[model samples]
Target: MSIKITGTGSYIPNVITKNADFHQHEFYNIDGSTFPGDNESTIQKFKAITGIKERRYLDDNLNTSEMAIIAAQKAIEASGIDPETLDYIIVAHNYGDVKFNCHQSDTVPSMATRVKHHLRIKNPSCVGYDVLFGCPGWIEGLIQAQAFIRAGMAKKCLVIGAEALSRVVDKHDRDSMIFSDGAGAAVLESSEEKGGILAHESATYAYNEANYIYFGKSNNAEAPQDLRYIKMNGRKIYEFALVNVPKAMKSCLEKSGKSIKDLKKIFIHQANEKMDDAIIKRFYNLHGLDVPEYVTPMTIQELGNSSVATVPTLLDLVINGEIENQELKDGDVMIFASVGAGMNINAVVYQY
Candidate 1:
């Protein structure tokens, strides 16, 4: 038996925020000092490094759980599965649901419970829970689902990654422009298929990197003493990812009994274009191979970094033929990888 991703779905918000939108906003350094140079030059440098021209933000009326519900519905529909038959519902996220202009994160009932409730699944045995593993959360959710199936604890599961990052960002911080809001989901089930998830690798380097990404007071020091927003040490994260992520991916692929040449595509977290490009190059170098053209499909150029939502969202788009020149075919070998807060990193070697 194999655990296969039977269906995939994603919710890309309708609100398009262009880079030019920040041109008039005040930018500040992490130490609350005035940002050097003007907004145009700042944005240009940002674009050159990250390749993000625009991003999507959740509408004011919707929250992260609501977006999860939508993506879950689509996945359920695509899978043609009865909602009541699901054995587990896993929602991955960082900040629960932060209402527009609200600083508090609502996770009392848990995002998974909220999704199951909104999906209207009445089965009491369909356990619902949340996983807080940072941007790799969704991929981690998939790994968990596979474990449950392999252990005979579940037959079918729904895994979702959703976030309203726009609501958690500090406008005064330039990194705020790198964040957006979205959700993605997939249905996993045990099947007699020959190829599915072959292997996975996960790690947390919190000893010295625990604070690479964290919540801190806004760049505007005088804004509030008690309130905090999502923040990160960009240079630290980039350096850390380059050193560690490729090794994890290589380990996973090796465990799958597959060679580097077998990989058809790589679905990596949409954090930064340059960072991802560097990771992929290093990944191939480990195998003494050159990076293949179009081996990686990216949505980051338009969708920005939506944390947990990036990998699954990219998979959903490619599988549905929404991304030009990128397609997933049966019998294709692929790698899914991500790195984020918790100083965490994970990779899954899957056969489509």
Candidate 2:
């Protein structure tokens, strides 16, 4: 049996924040001290590099699980499957339900459990849980769903990646612009059909631990002395993705016995456009093929990096005709890849 993605859905916050908004605000270093710079030039450079012009942010009253419920409901509706029939719900997220401007977050009941409750799923047999794998969490969840289906442990599963990153981002830090709030979900069901998930690969780099995100007081500028926010070594992550992501994608494609020519499009994580382009070019070069920009669709320019939600959201948009110049057909091969905080990287090859 193979795990088929029967439906896809995504929800992005209605509030749009422009990159230029940060220019009016003062930035702070880790130690709560002010940092001075040409704000306009800095923002310009940021946009030139990341290709992020704006992003969505959930209202202060909302949380990650709520966004996930919206996405999950859409996926279930599209799949024409009853919530009661869902065998499992695997929620992929880094931070749990965190309130805006609040440092405390609660993970006790798990985000998946919260989603199941919000969706009014009454079946006690419908197991729910959360997966924490940095940005690869959703794809990793799909991989697990594939295993469950093959092992006869589940017949249907809801895989979701939701993040309220704005809750954790430090407004005074430049990194805040790269984080946003959104959710994406997919309905995976056991199918006798040959085209579904063909192959997948996942791995971590312990040596790059320093590149991961962590909560700590600002070290560069004084931003209230005790304020803790999401922090990471951006340069390290950029370098790591340039080197590791393509290798993982290549490995996944090889494992599926599919060449780059067989792929219709690659739905890679919407982390950084330049980095993603570089990675894809490197992958094609390794195989002696020219880089094809048309095969790689991107949403980062508008959606920013919604962490794990990036790939699934991009996939949903493209498959539903919401994305310009992109479409997926029956039996078309597609690849999904992501890299994030754990220095974790993963890729999945699927038949659409």
Candidate 3:
């Protein structure tokens, strides 16, 4: 059996955080020292570097699971699939149920479990769980869904990636500018049709610990540590993605027996505009072809980085004609790639 994504959905909170607004608030260096740059120039520099003009954040009352439910509802509605009939719900999130009740974070019941409850999915056998694979979590969830369908263990699965990064990111840290909140979901159904998830590849560079996220106080903090916020060494992550993501995409393409010439669009992780351009350019070079302008569609300029939600949300936008001059026809081949905090990376090929 082949696994096909019958529907796609995404939910971004209504609150817009513009880069220009950051200067109104004070920021701190990683060492907790006062940042010295002028806010206006800093915002301009950030725009030039990341191409992010703004991003959305969940409301105070919302949490990761709730966002996942909203996105899942849309996906089920689009797929015309009854929630009662879903065989599984796989939620991919870096921080599970962050900002629960506007005060705390917890993962005991799993984001998928909470989403299942919210959707009122009555089937006791509709397995629900969460996957933690950094930014590639959603794509990894898709891989698992494909496996279940191929193994005849499940006929349909809802794959969701939701994050409330706004709640977890330290307001004082520079990393806060790039993180956002949102969720994206897809309904994958078993089909006799041959092309859905064609082939995929993933890897982890465990030694690249400096690029990973951790929960702790700043290096220079003297006060009692509060919540552990998202932290990272930007240079390491840039170097890692520049080298590995293209390799993973190329391997996935080779595994799927498809060539660069056969692809339609490449939905890459909305991490950074320049990094994405470089990665795609390198991938094309591997095939001895120039990178096509339209081959990789992007939303990072407006969405920032919501980790795993980036790719699926972009996919939904393209599928529904939300992106200009981008639409998928039946039998079109597409590629998805992401790299992040696990020092983890993944790539998947799909046919629409």
Q: Against the true structure, whose TM-score is highest?
A: 1
Q: Rate the local accuracy (lDDT) of all candidates.
A: 0.96, 0.88, 0.87
Ranking by TM-score: 1, 2, 3
For all predicted structures, in order, the TM-scores are 0.99, 0.96, 0.96
Which pairs clash (backbone N, Cα, C closer than 3 Å) in model 3? none
Q: What stretches of model 2 exceed 4 Å from their correct place?
A: 29-36, 219-221
| lDDT of model 2 at position 63 | 92
Which portions of model 3 miss their true places by more than 4 Å? 100-103, 219-223
Candidate 2, 186-261: lDDT as tens digits: 9999988888999999998877464566777755453466767688777778888888888899999999998789
lDDT of 1 by residue, 149-231 (tens): 99999999999999999999999999999999999999999999989999999999999999999999999887996998999
- Give the distance in Å from residue 221's predicted Cα in candidate 2 to where it truly belongs: 4.5
Question: Model 2 compared with the native: what TM-score?
Answer: 0.96
Ranking of all candidate structures by their lDDT, best first: 1, 2, 3
lDDT of 3: 0.87
Q: Which model, 2 or 3, shows the larger lDDT?
A: 2
**lDDT by residue (tens digit), candidate 3, 1-352:** 6789999999988999999778786777877888777878877887888889999998888888888999999999999988998999999998787663453678989889899998988899999999999999999999988888888899999999998888877677766899888899999998888789899898888874634666666544654486467788777778788888999999999999987899988999999888899899998998899987688888998888999999989998898999887888999999999998777889999988
For candidate 1, the TM-score is 0.99
